[model samples]
Target: MSVIPAELDGAVIPGGCADCNAEQHFRQDEPGMWFIGIAHDDWCPTWRRIQAQRAGLPTTFLS
Candidate 1:
């Protein structure tokens, strides 16, 4: 199980994960293998999954 670090629920209302830094999560588990840190479901925004997919478009190389 994951431990809720102190700083996570500190002064910051939308307390983010000290390990990652996500903007949305429960006081529990998170999604994805590359967890950017558990976020505050009630405070922070959604997780960082779709955001990643929308990042810089993929590229292909050929000779």
Candidate 2:
């Protein structure tokens, strides 16, 4: 269960983690991990798995 930290409420960074600073997340192995006082899910794992499972289907794209 990942919840946005109170300190990062309303924080915004283009191309970076929506919940934390982008510069802090440097580990390539877990690119989806965001540095918000801890390794938080910038992109939720369940959603990532779902996206992976649906990969290569034309419906995955949007018009």
Against the reference, the lDDT scores of all candidates come to: 0.41, 0.44
> In model 2, what is the error at residue 5, expressed in angstroms?
33
Give candidate 2 regions above 4 Å deviation: 1-42, 56-63
Query: In model 1, which regions exceed 4 Å deviation?
Result: 5-12, 15-24, 30-56, 59-63
Clashes of each: 2, 0
> Per-residue lDDT tens digits of candidate 2, residues 7-45?
443344333335543332222223334443234355756
Candidate 1 lDDT over residue span 1-63, tens digit each: 335553443233444555344454323234322223444343333434445556746545322
Q: lDDT: which candidate is best?
A: 2
What TM-score does structure 1 among the candidates reach? 0.18
For TM-score, the strongest prediction is 2
Q: Give candidate 2's error at residue 51 in angstroms.
A: 0.2
TM-score of each: 0.18, 0.22
Error of 2 at 10 (Å): 24
